[model samples]
Target: MAVCLQLTTSNSSMCLCQTFTTHLFLPILYSAMFLTGLAGNVLSLWIFMAKISGKSPTHIYLINLGISNLLLCITMPFIAVYYALGTSWSSRSLMCRLAINVLTPVLHTNIGVGMIILAWLALSRCATLVQHSHGPRPSKCIKILPKVFFSRLRQTPFALGVCMGTWAIVATASIPSVVVYSMKETEVVEDGDKQTCYSVAVEVGGSGSQAFAVIGIVIFFLCLLVVLCAYMAVIRHFYRSRKSTVISDRQRVYARVFRNIVVIQIVLVVCLLPYHIYKAIFINLAQTDSGGNGTECHSLSTYVEIKNVLLCLAALRCSTDPIMYFLLDKTFKKHTLNLIRGRSNTQDSHSSRTECGQSAPYNNSSPKGAATHDTHSHSKD
Candidate 1:
């Protein structure tokens, strides 16, 4: 859900960038995210692993996503501490080493992994919604759509494999760049500076690191495109299946799915897109203008500060993810409410299928079911 924030470099005389955002803003924002994201992710993970009975493909993917969110939350305090202390730590200290070696890698790994997970989740949802559609009998084109995207995305085993694969791929993509930057480059900073985290060595990285960053930007856009297309396809499918003269449980199911698509896409666009887009531009600028090299704080001017601000926005996803899960997943909502109401939901957990439904529960529902928010609105695929 969130990210690593670097302080502005120490050459304020060369540029107009504020010197205090790392001190005044990052610590506060990361602290708020830590408190909120930690509680939300812990609760979500519990519900997904323990409370939900029918572990649909969506729930399986969500479990992995929750793990990423939790990891990001775990890194927040160290980031907050680094910023609040004015971004200074003894270069030889344990905290400084951990910040450089552990925190940076973990934060980045989870951010890439989170984006990949979201893309897969969107595709899975699209597949399941189409597979379970029951409004009007689907046309020939509708019948073939699931196969084109992924027919087995709804299967728990396949979904698990896909999630594991996502983590492996994203983690692999992130490691080389981080290793090059953190090890080969970071130690070459000025001798007397107190900088440990935010320095030319840390920000600029090796020239080869730029190539890897380009790879990352390409991957990010591809994933974003997948999310947009799959969610849009589901929305279009719902439209084609509905009739003007009659409204059925199928239509209601379609309506709910549409609302979900809107919410999920909005979250992706708002939280993640800007950073990836700007990262591409930053890389382009750094490469084309040799005089304005990333290796010098004076040359970079305000670019590094802008980069950190956008990264902070991307990290805001951590807090928003749990809220999104609660709003989007029916099974998640039910368990959370039971906990809030002080009711033991052990009985319900075993009896009901998760929101990622396996049954055609929506097919036979009464039209009046739309008026009530019962768990029986024909659950999604």
Candidate 2:
């Protein structure tokens, strides 16, 4: 969260207000998110990097997503501390100002990264399932959609490029916006050190900040639509597979795919949807209700609290993601179990030996062994 000051009639007119939510609730919520998110993401990354055998595109996507999640998790303590003690910290306090400048970008950046990665995961999985399916082609589901668009996402190299591109795009979009909000046009907050963190500027924000917010919300909805469409297409393609007289081995794989999609979709809806939706309303309200005395907070008193709460909900995904990974991917679950049980995964050990230029009795480095590893990984996907 950033410190905000309105550019209305006069900066002094705005009430730098505080409530139970800002003072008491935000710190508690952020602390919980930090503790859980840090643990979950660290564990997930360890499994992704060390334990899982196949470095498939989806796996690689997950790795990048975990990294982004960890980045956000690390910022939580700063945010918690900021809100927890903002009553005593003036708007001009160097530490609070610096933290806001740094972390507001981080919050936006990770949310963008998470959404884009989730979209990529949905599309990649949809492509994999459709390409391998014996049922009807994607033409039967979404006739306008191109198969070539999805094919490239099935490769690990492309996944890496996508993740890198996601970070660049999100950073480019987010950092500039944070600069616009916090650095430029900051005349309002410059008047005095008397303003606390709960000022009206913090609630509704300066008018200039909303321009990029509008663009970000548009992107958010577009990603949400793409995820839902891809999900539906995958369902349609696989629905026919399960209808067979007897379930094939591939159908069982598709069953796993179903669980994966369901989990991701649930995450998007449960965590991010409410925040974005209410954010849109708050933005619109802020834009329209600018006439009231900014001190009275006629437009945004209740809204700021709701938005912050829902934002915590959105951030909650980082904590929940590892649990979802454990349930959806057998490789992750198996490795996690093995690690916890204090046992080695023999297959992982064998693969590790081959990769490290060691001569194993069984040459798992052979072409056939390599194919087996990839095939098994894909099947798990």
Best by TM-score: 2
Which 10 successive residues of model 1 have the least lDDT summed? 372-381
The residue-by-residue lDDT of candidate 2 on 1-381, one tens digit each, is: 433343334433444445778777888989988998998899989878886554778778889999999999999888888777765666677766766688777987898899988888878866665555555433354356676666677778899999999998888777677877787634244543466655556556766788888888889999999899888987877787567525355566656667767777788899999998988898888777753553444446566778878988888888888888777666667667767887756866764445433211122335333333323444333
TM-score to true structure, per model:
0.82, 0.85
Q: Which lDDT tens digits does candidate 1 get at residues 1-381? A: 112233334542222123566566888899999999999999989987987655667777888989999999999998888656523555556776777778878887888888888888787766655555544555343565656446676578887998899888877777787778667766644445444455445555557777887888888899999888877777777787675426565567668767777887788898889988888888876666543335323465467667777888898898898898778766678778878988756556544543334333233254333223222321221
**In candidate 2, what residue range of length 10 has the lowest lDDT sum?**
356-365
Clashing pairs for predicted structure model 1, backbone only: 1-317, 1-318, 2-315, 128-381, 362-378
CA error at residue 74 for candidate 1, angstroms: 0.4
